[model samples]
Target: MWVVTGYAEVSTALTDRRLCKDSARLRAIIDRATAARLDGSRVAETVATDMLNSDPPEHTRLRKLVVKGFSARRIERLRPLVQQITDDLLDAMVARAADGTVDFVDAFAFPLPLTVICELLGIPRADQRSFRAWSTVIVGSSSRDDLRRTTTALGGYLAQMMSAKRSAPGDDLLSDLVEASDTDDRLSPLELVSMACLLLIAGHETTMNLLGSALLALLRHPDQFAKLRTRPELLDAAVEETLRYNSPAPVTTWRYAAEPMTIGGSPIATNDIVLLALGAANHDERFPDPDAFDIERQSTGHLSFGHGIHFCLGAALARMEAQVALGRLIERFPDIALAVPADELRWRPSTIMHGLAALPVRLGR
Candidate 1:
């Protein structure tokens, strides 16, 4: 296994066709490593069929079908809903801060995106909480039993949801996907459930981390926070900088070397599992004073959302959610400050995600 950390090398690895993402090839490697077939797990089998695990033609078809349902217009139309959700969460946060402190992650960061994504997917509000638990386990848990249990539950839930949509479709992404499944290039039942699971997990998990990390970044950099409060136009730039500085999805998923190739002069052999460190690449020497958190910096070309054919499909949605959520929080609480010392902050223990476990803050002066 090789970890590519240099900016140029990570960028190259992302676009290079030699780095394969095909699920069968990846499963073969995993099976070899574990000396057992992974097919015994039903949840694993269902989840493995997503676009993220496929190559060119298969990936292209899956992405095309999903893109139709997750259009730019669809995301843009949600701005009002995003704003409403942010405002409501802020109101709740303010109310809960009666003791002068509140866990922002619990009150705002987590629920805001969860609500939006659930609503977008046409998931009933009652079931949204279950997703939070399932997503947390799937992304953060180290226990295989726990992971299998949670995924099995989530897979079953999605199967039921898809069935409901089939009988009585709604004007939601899932229903759109159900309609797509009925077409000529239709998604198989496994693919349908897998795609929904991918969207459901990726949709909120990344954005939730983004919200928490962005606010944490601002709280640490008082000057930048103050500057954004006064110059609201920098909201977008602040979100971008936070992404580059503390990437929510810190590393790309595992990619296999289909053929021997050199990345930044280091030779990678066939079948080598490669992990591109997006967080490291974003902070590489390519960016002037990369360690410094400068909202005004030209933070373009960062691998925060990745590169090539696998760049985040939800980049626009994540950006919008962050911009709305962070912008509103800053606006509503002019004197918001960290409730504890900056050094006391703790991050979630996961290589795939960089996010705070909690963000306690004082909402008022």
Candidate 2:
């Protein structure tokens, strides 16, 4: 077995120029178990965006159009609303709980981010179930037939939503993107559709998993959960710690090295695949007792949001959403507990994301 666990090696590899995030990388990797069967066309069609695919200057221009709105300052302004959304979700969960037993994920974790994102995007409340189902198939499992169907249906719906935003602006990211496309970079209709597709899925699914994984970790380590509940101020740090501890999009993303670079003395060729193991990186010895979930740990160096110019554009929004969601969760259900055993829990077999199929949890005070 080959061993590779060091901050320097992983971070250096992630920021290197040798790796690339081209379509070929995903097509081959999506199915080591099934790839011998999928034709290149079928796989290439799944991911349609400049956000997760393509390098600068396409990435640079496309990212610039929306990055301004998601800056730390702007996201900070959105925090109170995030808090409200979190509170509302927890309220619903608490109302539904009977004898202290409730599916915390369905009750709280999943809905918090979904509701916030839908509100932010101005997606109609009535359409959430469809959006959730599509995102579930896209991120939860990677069956070729299922992914294609979800992608097409979801993409078409979001494209229409973007069209609506363009025709009649709203106080949401879609409107902002429409104006950005019209005035600033002149993004074509298809490009805008692709961007919407990226935001809708990436925005919702990642945060959903973040809450689930973080809550699971806390449940497994009840002492830490209590620490968070007792110290309200630790909420922000806890969010970052949870991100580093078990990032939602683990084992994927940041799949580029700009050119040939050497990592751990292993030569990676130009355009080679560079998979940053966020989970492994978080546990690297260089980070000091890496397994410990110390919310107080000055973890600004963490790569849960990634690094360099291509770092996740929505990092601030992600942080704000998770902080409010997790913070409110602990507030409403201080005695929250996992209703299922860890080993018995099923995980999404998607090659791109590391997330649970479902989180069975019960909430109480």
lDDT of each: 0.88, 0.72
lDDT by residue (312-346, candidate 2, tens digit) is: 77777887788777776777677778877888987
Per-model root-mean-square deviation over C-alphas:
1.3, 3.3
* Tens-digit lDDT string for candidate 1 (1-365): 79889998899889998898988789888788785566646677666788988998999989998786567999999999999989988888878885889999988888988898889899998888888888888778457778788878999999999999999999899998898898664799889999999998898889989999888888888899889988999999999999999999999888999988888778888898999999999999999999999999999898999899999998999999999888778778889888999899889877787788998999885
Clashing pairs for model 2 are 17-257, 17-258, 17-259, 18-257, 18-259, 19-257
> Which runs of model 2 end up more than 4 angstroms from their true locations?
1-5, 24-46, 254-259
State the lDDT at 156 in candidate 2: 75
Give Cα distance to truth, residue 1, candidate 2, Å: 16
Candidate 1 lDDT: 0.88
Most accurate candidate by lDDT? 1
